[model samples]
Target: MEEKMNSGLVTSSRKKLTIVDTDVHHGYRAQSDLYPYLTKFNAERFAEWGFGGLSTHLYTSSGGLHGQRVDFDAGEAGDGLGTIGDAHYCSTRLLDANGIDLAVLTGGIAGAASALPDVDYGSALCRAFNDHSMEHWIAKDPRFRLNLDINSQDPLGAAAEIDRLGSHPAVCGVMFSCGAPKPFGQRFYHPIYEACARHGLAVTMHFGSEGEGVNPPPSAAGFPSYYIESRQLRPPAYAVHLASFIFEGVFEKFPTLKVAMVESGFAWVAPLIWKMDLDWKGLRRHTPWVKRLPSEYLVDHFRFGTQPLDEPADPEAIKHIINWIGGSRTLMFASDFPHWDADDPMMTLSDQPEDLRRRIFAENAIETYKLSLPAISQAA
Candidate 1:
């Protein structure tokens, strides 16, 4: 059954299946949009310094929405990996079109902001972005939710920012760039996690600004020579953060906190957990705060987004591997909408069983994020 909206549009009944897209990138058309929310000093700095952020963009395609579908119009300019668009365009092309119930807006620049060497500017940029998001994006649609972007380099400021906006009705979680100079588990970042746990907000690690600015190489071995290599190393980039979260006992400290890994394939998850579980048996003494098998903590506290999901030679191979890792319980549906590689909800897991599809598309996210589903209003 479909539900009709005030706009005279229809969507799949929420009662039937609630499609909560975990990863939807949104942002300002340019830094100028942030000026209204930015402090005078920051606004002036932005005017002069321009976007002082840097990343290993040298290895990735800088065109076509970062290789996103450039063909689809976001109804605003700078669809080329930008923040110029709004909810109406997205609704027409993605949400209502796909019958999606809710789509979390994971603005692309949040992670990149953290990559900046200038901590104050990074934090200010994030604050402005957060304010801008509330006014422009989240305010525009109930279907939209925001993951407040943060600069990990300024733990005190980041924690303060969390306390400032953690309780907002539309804000869902906090996001960190995977290009982080240190493991997420390090004490340097604890203040941010502590605030997140206090507010019961999940922490999201996403790809951005790796191998540039203050951030170290994307991989432990170091930066890759080419874009393809950079793409392949994406999963490992998350692996380091995951390992830090587990080994550093971030989960043990913040039992209520959750972390969602996005834009990273799930296939690498199984191997990493296997080795951690095995090594933890002997290395448990080194980190005594960890009270359980590493795998148990990860399974309990972590969630994964299925975007850019790996499609192996055998179509069924992903299903089997997903089951081995965590299956429907751990996976959540994400379209990465407006991006060239955005996965359509219907086309993404078509081969999987309907039961798993339903769980991944909605139930799992609701549980992990403790989502507050907005009341459904039917059109007369």
Candidate 2:
């Protein structure tokens, strides 16, 4: 268990841009690593039945294990079998290589915690994962900001968990996994949202746990048969949650609360909002609390991350999607690092204007999660 060592500085002088990767996945070698953080009762549960979620059992992985990076020296300098954890390895291989100023560590298995049948167990798992992250990853790197993993099943417990860890300096947001029993409106999960709003933490729904554990099927028509169909289903699912958050008055009640929809595509935002706005106009009385157009709420309170970004032959294609989703203000850059489909900073949107690229790559993330970092000056 030796840590790979490096300066941990981004060496931004080379790139002359402040890059913030909003969706970096940090993982544990095994559940045993988190045993110290878990309660004795739950520790036994974890030991008996590991990762009680069905998402992994269904999907086929690509690239390396779990579709992680295949080129990094995961164990030794000659290039090893893994690249998921080890903070210093990330510093040398990812941050320094790309000149990234900061990265938000979005816990990998956190989503499965939400999908578990037992609400109390799910919340406990989220808590243990949070504790494990605070020790292993956050304590290891200043560049690493964490989004606290929270179970959506136990709203009050999740809210209480947020109260416990929300004020931690390294915590910028919360990772609420998808595959929720209900689309995240319904006032059922308001306590969690309230706590996040109280602490200025963004509620980031990273795409995982689509059809897993006790959660519902990924789609209303039942589970999709193939991986490609599930990938395409991401945006529509997000659109449902987005609509739930808006129409159910989640945003109206918690005005300052922000959400980061991660790994879910952004192209559906336009059509969803258009239909929502049209329906609201004709049927505003059904939910009178929604005082404004859905798009207005989206513009003010939501941020979408770009990974597996749609790469049309030209970079210009993304701008249309960007404009449809309230401009670059709502777009945050996410690399989905260590995964096979991860986006490259220099390669994605390389042809865009410097300012726009800066916003999407760095500034939007900084704004979305309300992180306070010193201004970066470009190299002369």
On lDDT, the leading prediction is 1
lDDT of 1 by residue, 1-380 (tens): 44443233444444366689998878667657778878898899987875574533656573465555776664554423644366677766667666677888886566667777788888888898888888878878887888998888899999999999999878789988788778888989999988998888889878878877877767768867877777888887888889998888887778888899887868889998899999999888999999998888878888899987888999878978888777778899888766667787767887787799888988888887778777741210
Whole-model alpha-carbon lDDT for candidate 1 = 0.78
| Error of model 1, residue 179, in angstroms | 0.6
* Stretches of model 1 off by over 4 angstroms after superposition: 1-15, 53-56, 60-66, 74-84, 377-380
lDDT value for model 2: 0.77
Give lDDT tens digits, candidate 2, residues 48-153.
Answer: 8866634443667545554565664555221111226577777667777677778898855567777887878878878887888888788877788999988888
lDDT of each: 0.78, 0.77
Among these predicted structures, which one has the highest TM-score?
A: 1
Error of 2 at 306 (Å): 1.0
What TM-scores do the predictions have? 0.91, 0.90
Task: Check candidate 2 and list the clashing pairs.
Answer: 73-79, 73-80, 74-80
